[model samples]
Target: MLIAAASTIVLAVVVWATVVNTEGWAAVQRFFLDPAIALEYLSKIWDGFLFNLQVLAISVVTVGAVALVIATLRTLRGPVFFPVRIAAAAYTDLFRGLPFVIVLYIVGYGIPTITNTRFPPIVLGVLAITLTYSAYVAEVIRAGIEAVHPSQRLAARALGLGYVQTLGRIVLPQAVRKIAPPLMNDFLSMQKDVGLVSILGAVDAVRAAQNAASQSYNFTPYIVAGVLFILLAIPTIRLTDWYTARLRDREQMGSIV
Candidate 1:
């Protein structure tokens, strides 16, 4: 009964949207019919899109590497590990608490003012995202590392493996497998967060749409940008879902065995 009601509500929404949002519908139609215009808009945005991708890719890779190191250090038992863990915790808290837009502004505008050096917009974008997401990724990685069985750690120690060796050989490989889905989800999030770079006048896809909309005095370009983002997100969502299912299946099989 609830499902039926929800379906009815959704259908009603579709009908209402079609009826009320005539301009949006017309924009969609215009976008589809004018191949050259759409292509030109896309071309203008392509460089920005590529820059966004570059920022996401570089930030993810760099942040992942740093997070892995921090997670490993945090897992170790010692005075050294205590300070390292506290620092890692602080870093994660600081970035995660702050808004990304504020971070971008600080990096893009504030840093240059303080340091008397002008960082490129893309560089600032990368730094802001890396600083923000690295914290979350660190926690994700740390949880994954902790999820590994204590027995594995003890066994490795008994086999005369050093702390680093144990983590390198046993802990990380298993933890990485477990965290693969969450990590991919983070990548998807970062991809979307690339739009935040637009605030810094980075000329990314969203900015391109804004420019086109301003010049054309129509909303079609913005709609096209939304469609493009959806197109990118859908595949990542599917891949993450598939990976999560596979990991769950593996866990179940291991339990049975």
Candidate 2:
């Protein structure tokens, strides 16, 4: 603690000395780190963050649900379900191979062009993010499913469990638990990807910041927007770390439940 305090104090002193140069400090103060400008921008954009959060929450839930279905389909065997499996494979491959921007543009603009009617920006954003992330989430979950011991499935069958029952009762629970950290990490990514939907002209934080920056003729609002995302993600990062540690502990000690 003492060492950290001393280092912080030393760093503060160095920064203070650097800023002591009046001309350079004035330019820095005028452009980037001015407290008043940052505060004003924050105030303007804070409300728009609610939209981002709304889109993020909706997208994460939808993607997780869709991906679970897709992952389950990917695990199905037997000739009867071969066509279903092929369709699932094709869906994941198509979406996962596309860049987010290209997907976003296609959904946001192309759909409107075809239907001759534009959906709400938030809706378009949610659709794009859900489609894009579901593929990735499916792969994450499929990997978790593959990592489970084959004996678990065999034992489930031996116990008179049907395939669906085995999957629901025995397999996915362990797989999801094993992959929770990465799932939450993707959610962290989803939180920020919500901002990308702003390209469709949603009143999200990024769009709000862009508007504020235009009005002010300064880019500080963009910095404020970035800082907001970082601040929001900090808790998720810590939780991911803590969850990971707990998972490691569970491996050595046994399942929490």
Candidate 3:
């Protein structure tokens, strides 16, 4: 432990020294690390960041609902449900294959053009995020649901539980526990991508940074925005790591020797 701590400290110091010793370091610092500029734009960027949080909050709820429905469809059995499963599978494939930027452009701009109905940029941002993330999340959820042992389902049925009841009472709880780590990872990614809504002309943190940079011709505001995002993500990142480790320990404890 001592060796590890010392090595980490040395590595950090070496990297910091290398950065500071670069020929263009001063110029880079002047442009990208200006304290005054960061301080000046912090308020505006923070306001925009609040908008991003709002979008993320809405997208998380909608994505969960949509993804659960898609996953449930994919998990349905019997020939009668084949088409539904196929449709759900196709939806996940199409969205997962397409770049999120393309989805954002389509939902944010193309839909409005086709329908001739202008929606708020925030609405479009939330919709775009939901459409894109729901696919990835649905796949994760489907995998989780399928991971449950077949015997569990059979046992539930033997006890007279219907399909929905078995799924809700017996299968889903276990699946959620298994998928919690990856789902948290997806949510972490969502936190970062929420800023992509700036491309839709929403005055999100990134857009606010862009606007501030344009006025002063310095890149410090962008750095400030990036810092803010990092700060916002740190808590979730730490939580994910802690939860993953706890889960790993629990699983190891339960495993047969």
Candidate 4:
């Protein structure tokens, strides 16, 4: 632990020294770290960040529900369900392979063009996030479901449990434990991407920072916005690490040498 701390301090000092020694360091600091500009724009950027949180809250619920349905469809057995599984697979493959920014553009721009109606940017952002992240999350859930031993399903069937009952009671709980870490990671990614609503013209944190930068010609607001996001993610990041460690310990408790 002492060695690790010493190495981290040395790395920090080296990085600081290198950055401060640069010829453009003064200009860089003036543009990106001006305390006055950051303070001036803090409230506006925070308001915009609140919009990001609202979008994230809505997307989380929708993504979980939609992904679960798609996963269940993918996991269904027998030739009769082949078409359903294929459709689900196609959806996951298509969205997973597409860049999220492209998906955002298609859903954000294409929808209004086709329907001839304007939707709010926040609404469009949530829809794009849902469509894209649901595909990624569905695959995670499907893998979790499949990771359960086949014998568990067989035993549930022998006890007269129906398919849905068996899944809900005997499978999903275990799958959730196994997949929680990855799911949290996806959610962390989603939280950051929620700021992309600015592309659709929403006055989100990123947009607010852009506006501030335009007015002051200083990039400090952008840095402030980024710092805010980092601050927001810190708790979730720590929680994910703690939970992953706890889960690993539990799994290895009896078998550890």
Candidate 3 lDDT over residue span 1-257, tens digit each: 99999999999899888987788899999999999999999999999999999999999999999999999999999999999999999999999999989999999889999999999998999888988899999999999999999999999999999999999999999999999989999998999999899999989899999999999999999999999889988998899899899988987995866
Measure candidate 1: CA RMSD.
4.2
How far is 132's C-alpha from truth in model 1 (Å)?
A: 0.4
Off by over 4 Å in 1: 1-37, 254-257
Global lDDT of model 1:
0.82
Q: What is the C-alpha RMSD of each candidate to the true structure, in Å?
A: 4.2, 3.2, 1.5, 1.5
List, residue by residue over 64-153, the lDDT tens digit for candidate 2. 899999998998889999999999999999999998989999999999999999699888999999999999999899989988999999
After TM-score superposition, what is the CA distance of residue 60 in candidate 3 from its true location, in Å?
A: 0.5
- Count the clashes in each prediction: 0, 0, 0, 0
Candidate 1, residues 1-257, lDDT tens digits: the string is 99999999999999878864667766556644455556768777666677777787788778888777766666767785688778877888899899988898888889899999977887888888888888888889999999999999999999999988998899989999988888888888888998889988888888988898788766667766767777888998999999888878876885763
Q: Pick the candidate with the highest lDDT.
A: 4
Shift of residue 33 alpha carbon in model 3, Å:
0.7
How does each model score on lDDT? 0.82, 0.89, 0.94, 0.96
Q: Over the stretch 102-190, how does candidate 4's per-residue lDDT look in tens digits?
A: 99999999999999999998899999999999999999999999999999999999999999999999999999999999999998999
Q: For each candidate, what TM-score against the reference?
A: 0.85, 0.90, 0.96, 0.95
lDDT value, candidate 2, whole model:
0.89
Looking at candidate 2, the ten consecutive residues that score lowest on lDDT are 20-29
